[model samples]
Target: MNIRNLAATFVIALFGFFTLNLGLDYGLRNTVPHVLQRRLLNRVTADVVAIGNSVIASGFDVAAFDRASGMHSINAGLGAAEFAQQYVAWKLVTNERTDIKQVVFGTFDYSVTNTKPTKWTTWHSNNALPFYADPSWSIRYGCASRADEVVYLLARRVPLFTERGGLWTKVETLRRYLGGVGFPAAQINRFGRISDSKLLLEQNTEVFERLGRSIVETRVPLVDPVADLLKEAQQKGIASFMVLMPLPADRRSFYAMPGWKAYVVYLRELLSQTGTRLIEATEWSDSREDFADFVHLSEIGAAKFSTRLSEAMQCAK
Candidate 1:
């Protein structure tokens, strides 16, 4: 190609890229949910803050917990968040707040042990945006290598890179709406869509059984970011507890496995070293009607579970 033609093509590409980035930055910053999430992170002052992935987001009934415990609480859970993102949410929400007396982390099998940093291009990036936007934090907890650190640092400065997840979120939202158009309307709450929590132990029994067996066989170890969360909470004199959120009947049966029992014993020992209590609420709810899916609690279940959690906390105190 001619030099002039190549130059013109390059200029057009640059302009398009700049315009796309500008549009994405504006759209992501102004979205209602994103704005509200930011507001919650900055303004929420509660006696308790619960942080985790979607399980906590969809399962923790903040209002029920508040009513039952007579203490205000915020569910700072983020869908698809990993341990690093969960830690970031806690840090951002509790950074200057002295009113937060306790922090509850909702976890399931191997969640605490999975320390993989979220990708900046996927939907999960939205959950980790607060920390990934900061080069230092992204470097400290996100990137696994020097090359990754460089990319994270660059993504921190570029809206096109960092907000890719927001764009994907928009896409997913549209897809869900379209996909559900012909189906009966889904039951949704403030947390999002709810699945019918039925007590069908036979449904997906094999999947859960295999998952349990795999977990028992793999025996993953705890990672640094999770340990950091517990240690930091201890250092700040805030109570930190990791609750093993309710599981389906098929999944719960794995607890009886000898390997799984041994793994839990080791996990408890590690948690004790950091003064973090591991609360096993796995068998808290047995009925399938309490679950939104295989792992999360439905609205009814969330209310019931939150009340029980409040009682558990009171007894712990």
Candidate 2:
């Protein structure tokens, strides 16, 4: 073909491909986010909706808490979520369920920041697209950079080149495929998602904690966006509280880099300034045995904390 014809064909194909990408992103139902959207969109009126990162996502057992508290609840925790995504979750839950009398936000050192790859990973868009159709969500929930979007589409969705996660998870996936079985039970429900698995006995907590600390400290800090949301909820007469969820006592000292210590101090000041009710992880002291990881509570831990949270709500009431 002549150069002109070849270039024209290339342009047409590119446009078609881009259109297809858009269609797939919006049209197809997202696996994880859809669950959350359905939970919120359902006509159920929950008294407490816990929104945070993975800490509470899989950590809090909403059903157990509901049984204990005698109040409806839901856990809207996203894995690897930072403040921006959690705030969106908060908005989503409250907006959909006006009967939400209280909101329990799971706050950590980095819960107020966007340094996490919410945009690049399409975590935000995955949740927002189902209910929030605004074009702005493309930037808010997706990679703002067109170049990055191209890369994500190529890497994540393209069949031959999907992200396989860590080496162990890869091995686990292969094991399941080869062995005609599945990974150990991953229980997800409208209440929440929690793996029944326990944290590995010899897991290298220190190294992972250090790496997490390093990445967080290098990013520019953000103001406590949750504070504003809480303030609004309070104004609307929606009771609200914060949970200063830190790593387990054993690993906290090792994990809290200098910057993290400073961030905690700042967080405390912010809470004091706003008069936000708080449930610090240290207060209850979840046993090290109850953790599935450095912070996420296991099922037994979830049972314990869910009861504690229920009792706390009783006191609040």
RMSD of each: 4.1, 7.3
Q: After superposition, how far is residue 117 of candidate 1 from its true place, in Å?
A: 6.5
Worst 10 residues of 2 by lDDT: 159-168
By TM-score, how accurate is candidate 2? 0.63
Clashing pairs in 1: 197-289, 198-288, 199-288
Per-residue lDDT for 22-101 in model 2, tens only? 66555444445555656666646677888776778866898788889888888888765545556666767776456888
Question: In order, what lDDT does every prediction score?
Answer: 0.72, 0.59
Candidate 1: residue 316 lDDT (0-100): 68
For model 1 the TM-score comes to 0.81
Each model's number of backbone clashes?
3, 0
lDDT of 1 by residue, 93-170 (tens): 777678888989888765676545555334244454553433454356655578877776666667776666667767
Say which candidate scores most in lDDT. 1
